[model samples]
Target: MPSTPAIVVTDLVVDRGKKPVLRSVSTEISAGTVTGLLGPSGSGKTTFIRSIVGTQKVKSGTVQVLGHPAGTKPLRRRVAYVTQDASIYRDLSVKANVAYFAALYGRSRHEAMQAIEGVGMGDHADKLAGNLSGGQKTRTSLACALVIEPEVLVLDEPTVGLDPVIREELWDRFRALAAGGATLLVSSHVMDEADRCDRLLLLRDGVFIADDTPADLRAATGTANLEAAFLHLIRALEGVN
Candidate 1:
């Protein structure tokens, strides 16, 4: 049986200056499942993700996380969010950065090492962040997010600049985390990664066009691949409007 939704958004609306970013967006993300927010570069994926994480200002809507309103004080330690921007102590070693963040969450240093190892950074843990490669830095950022053992993790374009091998390894780790009952909301514009998600939320221009499992997406569109499936959805939506 399926569990309750980890997050839910209803009639979500977000406006930036004079422009409206999201338009009546609504969706329920299943707990303990990996749900990919798949879209193009300017499709409001980041904005929607920020909304879910309770950082983006909403014009009107409700975002509920774990049965409580988003941004509530109680959820501060329960939700871990990692943005695309790689911000860490350049002078600090990878291990130190992770351990420090864990301490901020009231977690022990041992848990920090486990998180560093989870992101495949145990060997490079002692390496200075300033000297690590871009991919390694990204891994360090992810390890920091894992320190709190959060129930919900929201990552924005985590694999964007990573190499194929590192991307594959991170995806495997994401699956492992989900299997352990952690809900992950990973945003990516890369269509190739769509099929890896347990479920997908297809977004374009701040609106959801389709929400279904990858297999269902393929079968409904009668397409052999995810790219083709997304195209079919776009055309179908175009015809309706």
Candidate 2:
């Protein structure tokens, strides 16, 4: 992984109508690396992602992307966020949707088609996005994000509803993106996906339980896998041996 910090969060605190969502979270994600945000549902994973992308408001702390404040104009094209919900135009064809996003970035139709192919949605390019299956729609959404060639990419539960094959394909694409020097932060509740990442940030109850490499996390917890390590960490936090 590159030594430079691509994204930085310092003592972040987020609240949703008086209920704490993220509690003093802090971390530095390196450039040109794929970092997994692993956590259970309602563990502040999505909230933390929004904070990094500069969409969610925070009660305290600071989040910076590429040395500037998150969500600022300078980082607009440099950062791309793909939420769990596919944010494409349902009425538009897959190609049209992706091309429209490419247009926004002043990219050409060729680039739009290239992005669609990059996500393995080339065969379904002409299909209406609304008629696509869950996995297809997710890939279509990813194509839109890839059009910008962002420096930092954030994905919130991108593989949650995908099948095994599609999930594996997406992970491969993620690895390729990182290899090209883009910093990627992908969130997933599935423990099996943990090994696909270069580093992991484990969140629980609005705070980080652990932050380390997959192998190191397993070794530290004396577990055989990430799921077991997660459970062991939780039990230890609850004063269980």
Instruction: Tell me the whole-model lDDT of each prediction, alpha carbons only.
Output: 0.92, 0.95
In model 1, the runs with Cα more than 4 Å from the true position are none
lDDT of 2 at 123: 94
For all predicted structures, in order, the TM-scores are: 0.97, 0.99
Root-mean-square deviation per candidate? 1.5, 0.7
lDDT of 1 by residue, 108-216 (tens): 9999999999999999999999999999999999999999999999999999989999999999999998999999999998999988899999999889999899999
Best by lDDT: 2
Question: What TM-score does model 1 achieve against the real structure?
Answer: 0.97
